[model samples]
Target: MTGAPPDVSIHHLRAITNESTVELPDRVVEILAAVGPDTDVLVSDVSARSFAAATRRSYSKQEPNLVPFINSLQALGDELVLICQVEHGDELVTAVVRATDRSLVAATAIDRSVGIVHITVQELCARLRASNAPGVELALEVASQCLADDRVRIFEQGALSTARTVLTKYTMAAEKGFDVRGLDGFAGALVPLGDEQPGFCIVQADTSVGITAFTPGNADVVAAMGIGGLSLHSETTEETG
Candidate 1:
């Protein structure tokens, strides 16, 4: 895996809910059919409760840009469908259309970009507690293991606060050239540790994690986690709030 080209574009789609049952639109079906076998695709119900049978490939490659796919589902005007395509050496393309009206609600192409670093467990715990999102105790346990180990695997639905904590720690570790891996299904923003550096805040989509730091040596690990890489830089200064 290599760094995403600096010129990569980020796209956005709206998120809406549909409670009716509707057939997959022909245009969407066509797009899915047009996807080459070499391309990786994942189709899931709007609830993301289960991945559709269309998911045909390992998620080991670049993380699929899901913003458009998720957001467009609501516009489908009935049942929602998510289609994420990742092609070799190409930008992630995600699009969804309304089956009833045949209108393209959202489509976007995005490439992985940068992320922050070097926070202590105490501070991490403080932030988690401050978030007031549920599951702080469990998040603390995960954070302790994450800080102490080179890699740790967590298989659980983390609370929003838990996700934010992991994102901060993982980005921080990657910045320090440590090989970090494995956490899924959480959402949060990357807040710069202090005011000296530009304040970079990213409110990521659900089930997506972004890496703010990475070296050539750890690219494979970063890719395996299916998280985007951001190139932001920051100091090791602690957060006083």
Candidate 2:
């Protein structure tokens, strides 16, 4: 799929939940009615027990901005579901994201639902770091495959958080054609060189794992930073004596 454009615009719709039953709000129903037959939409419930559904059209080889949709829904309540669809590259892509204890659960444009797919931060990072594929494409693949299989588990609480830091650094480095401070907060800050070429440098790849911080600017950067991988703290941290 082609990358997202700079200055991307996203359409948002929200529905309120009823206290008696789990029915959608009028606004949500209205938005769904407005969606065209050709357009796909994503529906998600981000309550404590999160759930999500994506329309079939979302799988097409195009990009859609669902960040606003997710963030808006997140603000409304700890528990709510919203559906949204956007057109990019003339193709319809529907998606949903749910916040869970360890990480945010999201849906893919493909038939696979993002909520059901279980990809940990470590596996995603290792795979992206190893592959030559664009960040977005690879993220879809990794998330999809993980969902299809039951035996694989690579993430913990800190994975996605860590991935974001790496992604920010990678994008900043590429954006300036040089390093940026705080990009690698965990690692010591790389010395910032304004004009002169530094002798030592951290390697920056052309593509990045797709994640929110790197989005909204350009599809290339989105593709480059597709869903940045997670950084998982060891499962077995010791308690202080």
* TM-score for each predicted model, relative to the true structure: 0.28, 0.21
lDDT tens digits, residues 1-241, model 2? 1121122123322221111233333443443445555443222222422221121122222224444433444454545322223333222233333323212223222212232223344444444455443333434434443323333321111122223335444566447553222233321111111111111101112322233112111111112223222233312110000
Off by over 4 Å in 2: 1-115, 134-223, 226-241
Model 1: per-residue Cα lDDT at residue 28: 36
Report the error of model 1 at residue 120, Å. 6.7
- Measured on C-alpha atoms, candidate 2 has an lDDT of 0.28
What C-alpha lDDT do the candidate models reach, one value each?
0.30, 0.28
| Candidate 1 overall lDDT versus native | 0.30
In TM-score terms, which candidate is top?
Answer: 1
> Alpha-carbon error at 19 in model 2, in Å?
29
